[model samples]
Target: MKIQLASSEADIERCYPIVARWREIEKRSQFVRQIQEQQKFGYYFVYLEDDRIEAIAGFHIIQTLARGRVLYLDDWIGETSEYTSGYSRILFDWLMDYAREHSCQSLRLNSSVRNIQAHQFYFKNKMKIEAFQFSISV
Candidate 1:
């Protein structure tokens, strides 16, 4: 098992299918292009076993008046059925380790209010609900 940042185009492209499964990306090209643009401040991390990608995490470091320097996770998905298994733990642990290594004050991610399962997982991981995020679609 290995976790790595998808820095090369080939590695990033290899993550497209898994990402598309959980995201509404319309095309692989669009995914690549958008990833490229975001790479200026963010990163895509892939979890691999036997060279097959099993999970992906997209994150960026940010400084906020409330949180200070935070490792903000933007996207996360793993094999649909197996996401609740240890594989997710490995990936999540990796992300946490990374945050500590970078001297981040916290690691955070937002799950939709309707995603009870994800919320449960976050709770299981010992993450607290710090605030309510209110948004209106424009």
Candidate 2:
């Protein structure tokens, strides 16, 4: 297995399968380009095994009064059936390791309140319900 920040257009192409589960694939290349080039805020990382992308994480570092320096996990997805598997845990552990290496005070991600399964997974990973998130489309 190999894990690294996804850098090339080809890398983004390879990421399509895992990410397409949540978003439209036709728009993916453009989105990946924006994240890799236009945004100064984040990086997209991919986990590959036997040359196939099995997971992807999009994260950024941010400083806020409440959290100090933190790792903001904007997106994460793996093989749908692998959600509760050891592979998912491996990916998550990797993300946490990244936070520690970067000196981030906290690592956070917002899951939709309706995602009960994901909530359970978060709880299983020892994360607490610290705050509720609210959002509105602009």
Top candidate, metric lDDT = 1
Model 2, which residues run further than 4 Å from truth? 48-51
Residue pair clashes in candidate 1: none
Record all residue pairs in model 2 with backbone atoms less than 3 Å apart, i.e. clashing: none
The whole-model lDDT of each prediction reads 0.83, 0.77
Clashes of each: 0, 0
What's the lDDT for residue 94 in model 1? 92
lDDT of 2 at 28: 72
For candidate 1, the per-residue lDDT at 26 reads 95
Worst-scoring 10-residue span by lDDT in model 1: 42-51
lDDT of 1 by residue, 31-60 (tens): 988888889756655545545778888899
lDDT, residue 99, model 1? 91
